[model samples]
Target: MKRQVKPIREGNSEPGTVSLFSIAGIKTLLQFLRLGKKSGALLSMAVATAIYTWFYQWEFALGVTVMVLVHELGHVAAARQKGIPVTAPFFIPFLGALIMMKRNPRDAATEAYIAMGGPLVGTIGAFVSFLIGLFTGHSLFYAIAYIGFTLNLINLLPIHPLDGGRIASSVTRWLWVAGAAGGLFAVIFLKSFLFFVLWALFVWDLFSKYIVHRGKAAEYSCWGKIEVPFDQIPGENWMLIPFSEREPLPYRTYSDMDGKQWVDINWEEADVVHPVKMQEQGLIRSVFSTKVERRWQQTPKVVVLRYQIDYEPHEIENYYEVPEKVRWRFGISYGALAIALFVLLDLVQLMMNEQGGFFHSLRK
Candidate 1:
C-alpha cells in the first residue's frame, strides 16, 4: 500500500494532453468563442425566434428564422466579396433581418448587387422549400415556402428602404416619387402598421435626399463661367477660378470681341476640381485680344483708366459621370424586378386559393 506509483509518461498517456473541460482549457475555449462573436446578431435572432415560436410553433418559427438568416447572409456575402465591411445579420421580430454595412457602395452597380443578393438567395431557399413540400406532401414545408416567397417579393416593391427602391434610386432620384406612391398604397390598402412604418421611412428618405441634392447643387453653382473684365485677366494669362468648399484653381482665359465671348476659358487644373473631366473640357471656346483699346482722351490723350467687358455668361451645367458598372446594374435590376413581380403574383394567387389571402394564411 505504501509503494510509490510510477510517473505518467507525457507522450504515451492521454492525461498529458489538455482536457477540454479543465480550467486552462476552458479559459482557452472561452477566448476562442469570444473571438469574432456576433453577439448582437445572435441576440436578435434569439428574440425573433422566441417571438415567432410564441406566435406559431417551434418548427414554423425555426424555418422562418433560417430563411431570414439566409436572406440577410446573402447580402453580407455579396458585400464582403466586394471588399465592403459589413456586420452580421440582425433579425427583427416581425420586420425580418438586415445587415449593417460599414460604408456605402462606391457606385450604383455595387448598391444594386448588394440589394439583389438577399432576394436572390431568399428566392432559392423558398424554391427549395417548395420542392420539399411537393415531394413530401407536407403542409408545413408549403407554409414555410409561402412565407419565404411573399417576404422576399414584398421587399422588391419600389419603396424606400426596400431592395427595389435602392435599385431604382441608382437610376434616377425622380424615381423616389414612385417609391413614395408605392409606400402610400401599402399603407392605404394593407392597413397594416408595418406599411405605416414603411411610409414614414419613405418620407424621411425623401427629405434626406432633398437636403443632399440641395447641397450638391450649391457646390456645383460655385464652379462655372465667370465673366471678369479684360483688365482683371493677369498679364501672364493665369486666372483664378473660385469653387465652393474647395481651393481656387488656375484657369486660362481667351477673349473674342467679334463673337462677344469674354468667358471663353479652360480650366488649367481640371483634375483639381473634376477627376473625370466630364464637364470641364470643351466648356469654353478659344478667344484672344490683339490689342488694348484706349477708352478716354484727356490733355492730349494721356488718360488710360477705363476698360470694359461687354458680355456675361451664365454657369454651364455640371454633368454627372456614369460609372462603368451602371450598365450591368441596369440590366440586372430590370431582370430581377420582372422575376420578383411574377413570383409576387404567383404567391398571391396561391394564397388566395389556399386561405383567401396572404395575411389570412399568416393569421391561420
Candidate 2:
C-alpha cells in the first residue's frame, strides 16, 4: 500500500502562495529603494509638492515648485559655466530650494556671478508667469508670479548666505552692514519666526567673524599623519618639497577632518622637514648597560617616519577683484531687476483689485 501526502498550505492558502507573495513584496521594495536613490531631486520635489498641496491647491504648489527648480537650474548653469561642480536642487517645503557647491568659488566675483544667476533667471521665470496670467486671465498664475518675484527679491536682501550678500562681496563689504539692518527690519515687518531665526544666526556669524576672531587665523589639524621615508628627509635645515611629491589623498578626507577649514600645504613656504637639533652635554650621569644578543637575519630596509603638519586656511587675497565697470553693471542690473519685480507685483495687485474675476473666484 502506498501513502499519499496532502498539499502544503499556509492558513488555507494554496501551496507556494506565501513564498510568491514575499518574493514579489521584496522585489517591489527593492525597486522603490532604487528609484529613491536615483531620483532624489524628483522625490524631494514630490514630497515638497505633497506638503504644499496639503496647505494650498495642487496647481499652485506645482507651479511654485517648478519656479524654484528653474531658479536653481540658473545657479547650476552659472556654476557649470565657471567649471564649478554643483549638486541638483533640493527642495524644502517652507524654506525653498537650494543647490550645494562641490567646491567653493575662487573669488568674490565668481561667487557673485554664481549667486546672480538665480535671481536673473528666476525673474525671467516670473515674467513668463506674469505674461501667462495676462493671457489666460488666471489668478493662479498671477499668484505664483507674485510669490516668485517676492522670493527672488527677498533673496537679494544682501544678507550672508543670500544671493544679495554674495553679490555685495564683489561690490562692497559695506553691503553686509546694510544687510544686517535690513534683515532686522524684515524680521520685524514680516513677523515670521523663521526669518527672525535666520536673522539671529546671521547676526551671530557676523559677530563671531568680525568681532570675536578679527584678524585671527583659524587653526586646523590633519586627520592622519603623512608618512615620509627616513632616507627622503632633507639634510638642510629647511628645504622646499614639490607638492607633486606628496602622497595623494582623497579631497573629502581632508575636507571632512577640517570642516572646510583646511588649506593645501604651500610647499614653497612650508618647513615640512626639519633637521634634528643637537644639544651640548653639561655633565655625564651614571648609566646602566645590558648585554643583548640576537641571531643575524636579513630584514626589509623600508622605514617610514610619520609627521602631522598644520595648515592655515586659504583666504582670498583680493576679495573684490571685479572691475569697476563690472561692479557698476552688477549694481545696475540688480537694482533694475528689483524695481521691475516691484512694479510687476504692484501691477498684479492692481489687476486683482480692479478685474476681480478670477481672483474673486479663487477667494470663493
Candidate 3:
C-alpha cells in the first residue's frame, strides 16, 4: 500500500525550493564580496570601526576612523597628482591606516611632496572639526580635534617611515637629529610603549643611514654616463636603421638579496640591429647596448641607476636635484603646519577646560 503525502500550502513552497528573495539576497552578497576584492578599503574600514567601537564609545571610534581616512586620502590625492600609483587605504585597529605605493618616487622632492600631503590635509580636517566644536559647543568634536592635531603633530617627527622623515629628505637631513630628540620626548610625554618602540626603530634608522652608510651615500649616488664602444658596432649601416624597424628591447628591474636593485637587459633576445641606432640616440643607448651593465644605487629612501660602460664607472649627483627655492618652500610649509597644529591643540584644550574638562563634558 502507498502512503499519501500532505498537500502543500498555497503560500508555502516545497521543502527543497528556495524563495526568489533569497536568490536576490545571495546575488547582492556576491557582488559586495567582489567589490571587497577590488578595493578592501571599505571592508577593512568597517572592521576597524567595529573593533574601535568595541574598545571605546562608537562616537569616538567613528571620529578617529574618519580622521584617519581623511589623512590617507590626502596621501592618495598627492600620489595621484604626481602620477604615482598607490593602493587604497587599509586600516589597522590600533595602529592606523596606510596606502602602499605601486612604484617608488624617482626623487626626494617627489617623495616629500607625497609625504607632506597626509599631514597637511589631515590638519585641515582637524581644523574643520575644531570649528564645528566651537560652533556647537560639543565636547566630542573638540576631543576629536585634539586627537587629530596630536596625531598629525607626532607624524611630523623626522623619523623613517614617518611623513616628516620623507619631507626632510627634500628639506635637510639635520632635522633627523632633531627627530631623535623629539621622538624621545614624545615617547615620555605620551607614555605610549608602542611609541617607544617606534622611537627605537627611528634611532636605528638614523644610525644605519647616516653613520653606517655615510660613505656609501656619496659613492653610490644616482646618475651615470653610458658609452658604446665603436669596436662593438656591427656596421655603419646600423645607424641608418629606422627607429621603427628595430624591435623593443626587453628588460626587468629587481632588487637583490641585499636590497640592491639592478636592471637586467636581455641583449640576446633584442634585435641586434637596434644597438648602434640607440647609441646614436644617446639616452636610449644603455638598455640596447650589449656592452653596458646596469646597477642601481639602493638607499633607505631612494633607488637610482648607476651604469658601467666599457669598464669605466661614471657618477652624476642628480638625486637631490630639488631647487633651493623648493627646499625652502617645503621647510616653511612643514614648520607652519606644525605650529598651526600646536596652536589648535591648545585652543581645543582651553575650550574643553571651559566646558568642565573633556571627560566631564563627555559624561554629561
CA lDDT of each candidate? Answer: 0.58, 0.66, 0.69
The Cα error of candidate 2 at residue 357, in Å, is: 9.9
| Model 2 C-alpha RMSD to native | 19.0
Per candidate, the number of residue pairs that clash is 1, 0, 0
In what order do the candidates fall by TM-score, top score first?
2, 3, 1
Could you give me the TM-score of model 3 versus the true structure? 0.65
CA shift of 28, model 2, Å: 9.3
TM-score of each: 0.56, 0.66, 0.65
Q: What is the C-alpha lDDT profile of model 2 across 1-364, one tens digit per residue?
A: 1111232122312244445346457558657778653366776898899998897888888888988888888899999999888877889988888887777777888899899999989988988988998899777788788778888988888897889988888777888899999999999888989888888878877876677667875433222222233344455542333233233322211243212332232222232432211111111111111111221232322122222333344566675678898888888877787798789878877776765743463443
Which pairs clash (backbone N, Cα, C closer than 3 Å) in model 1? 255-287
Task: Give the poorly placed runs of model 3, Cα more than 4 Å off.
Answer: 1-32, 36-38, 217-317
lDDT of 3 by residue, 1-364 (tens): 1112222122212235656557457558658788754346887798899998887788888888999988989999999999988888999887788897766677889999999999999989988988998898778888888878988998888987889988998998888899999889888998999889988988976786567766553122122322233334355664444332133345555454432344444443223221111111112223322233222232222211122221112223576678999999999999999898888888899999998887765554
Q: State the lDDT at 1 in candidate 3.
A: 14
